[model samples]
Target: MAAAHRARHWSFGGVVLVVTAALVAAVLISFSGSVAPRADAAVAAQTWSDEFDGVAGHAPDGAKWTLETGGSGFGNHELQYYTNSTSNAALDGQGHLVITARKNTDAGLGCWYGQCQYTSARLNTARTFTQAYGRFEARIKIPRGQGIWPAFWMLGNDLGTVGWPNSGEIDIMENIGREPNTVHGTVHGPGYSGAGGLGAAYSLPGGRAFADDFHVFAIDWSPNSIVWSVDGTTYKTLTPADTGGKKWVFDHPFFIILNLAVGGDWPGSPDGSTAFPQTMTVDYVRASSSGSAPVARPIRGIGGMCVDVAGASSADRTPIQLHNCTGNAAQQWTVGNDGTVRAFGKCLDVAGGSTADGAIVQLYTCNGTNAQKWTYTAAHDFTNVGANKCLDAKGNSSADGTRLQTWRCTGAAGQKWTLG
Candidate 1:
């Protein structure tokens, strides 16, 4: 999605405004022995919105959006000249906004590749609105033709200073005419951007083209997580652990953007048979807010050590150990609604799906299997669903790198956890 990667990553964090060098180094060790819970709240309330109510031929709400006019390619090597004109974008008088891309040979606009061959519109809410974690979504019927591209995305508010990639970006939906039945959701950040962005694609069944109908595209974003869906089908989820060794840059506010480009590096150029007046119709767009920001505090246990991922590696099979509280992303765990305990984009899995007395716990890809599912009892026991065993500091020891394992439900100090 780097082709559309507006710029994006994450941790067990909530709306972080800044990241200094010290903070980066402290990722592994949480000082003060604070025991904090993994996460809280999902889509809470409607914080900001625009329903496109207006007369026909009117432009987008100027109070909420700023139309960006440029032909410098916007770093995408696109062909269209973005203009602030009603000719390119306007309300349809029926609760919908239509963004039309017209082939204009004589637009009389200065562009990176000489005279512009097309005209379209790009609108953003940089100055008027920004949100950190929430449900961001839109419903639209896309225009289809060779080289026609349309996107509903977001970029970090610190764009002017931090710049692309580092500023973060979340592409809720992007479609290229070449893939008539498909759309993609992506996150781009420092180590992962442009062509290397981490994301997934969704395609309509029955060989149906997205241009033939309006589809609901969205992302449910929270601390340390971003889930993407198309018409209610969840396709992908991203987290800080997915960025390799790079920083998770999605802890701040990001503004929304909607645009339709005629041609670009991703969709190529319009062909002779391509339609001239291609239109992208948007029915609505909305963002919901998160109630309480989730804190990825350390989970302290026996001897005052925290539950940790050995070596801070996100690779599958990484051991879950007992280490002196380090506030690093590797030690941060978020409790998923599905009863799965997660850290570094993976789940706390029973090794080999073992149901024995001494099976060690490890971080592995989250599958819906019972081995990866568990319930934290009121008494502080992390009991595995399938094995009916409780988490234990191996051999009741509290030493560093003491691997944790599952045992018969025990109320001993080794099995008790102090969570945030």
Candidate 2:
């Protein structure tokens, strides 16, 4: 997310890394296939961690985080003046980092609007640590108010050189007080920054507000993809193919940030419904990277064509078929941790949610049902749950437009598949 409204459309993908263009291009091509399912044995090792294990009423570990002091609205027309003072940010003695936002009408305190009306704290790991690919997570309990905006996110490490969007931004978690039950996870890159970012929201189940309790927010970042999740439930995944063919810029390291802004253009200013001395509590932050990188490749079968969505459409219920692989987004798929083979933000589904043989397989909204889940093995056989049938290329046809369906697993060539 761009900090300033005037620079909202700025691209964060500018700083080219030391990696060769060919290598980067290869990374993009590799995602057209399947992502190796996140293996339990291959769990990424912890690389960085902060458990908020500090004395109550003391500052956070100075070696891990630095307070960002400013009253410049943070480029979002924010009402808060960030300070390093313990009153705004400090350990709660309960093993939590409490970031408090209070009414600050003190004339001595300056703000872009002349006198600061609110006070908060923004902390970052800018100069201390940065990581390229890993799983970053935090467990947080946010504050509630009409205009309170709390966020846990990351910015590209090259921000010093390329500035805003050209350096990229990944918002792992963002919640505005007005939508207490909902939170957002978004990625900003060239051509899709600011309000145009590609993202999705995950609301608390049973209509519960997030501020009522602590929830884990995280992102599993890999070479060319990122998966966003809450409380271990994966909700969204993004890759280069989802960028409308724009440059993929999240190849290098990025630093983490956490802040609680009183008011901003998006959240507006806290009103009568809002209260002062609001605090956002954080339990911990952790980062990890896997020793074995997972492989992603296209599932090709019946005449060597890839399993594809008909017409490259994003519309629901589009028939999935055997088509000529052209490295387009339509053919790109990922085997997710939740047992789904997905593309275009949808899942490969059994039409009518049926369990009968010959059930048509199409693209549908991912609802985590048995019909949407598939167990893909090294043999390339996709066995559907509930239906208890295998994904088959009808009539063993290799021609484009040959619709795929579920049939009794014959172990035939039509059901057999290969990764391209």
lDDT of candidate 1? 0.77
Please list the residue runs of candidate 2 whose C-alpha ends up more than 4 Å from where it truly belongs after superposition: 1-41, 44-49, 93-95, 105-108, 132-136, 198-208, 218-248, 286-295, 385-388
Per-residue lDDT tens digits for candidate 1, residues 45-75, read 5667888999999999988777877687776
Prediction-by-prediction clash tally: 14, 10
TM-score of 1: 0.70
Candidate-wise lDDT, in order: 0.77, 0.77
Please, what is the TM-score per model? 0.70, 0.79
- Residues 1-420 of candidate 2 have per-residue lDDT tens digits of 332222231112212221111111111111323434334323446777899987899998888887877787766778888888999999988889999999886679988889999999888776566787767999999999998999999887766567667778898998888888889888888787877787788999899999999999998776656878898777887877788888788888887889998787888788899988899999999876633223344678988899998987766799999888887777776565456777765779999888888899998766768999887666668888768899999998888889999999998899987655
Compared with the true structure, model 2 gives a TM-score of 0.79
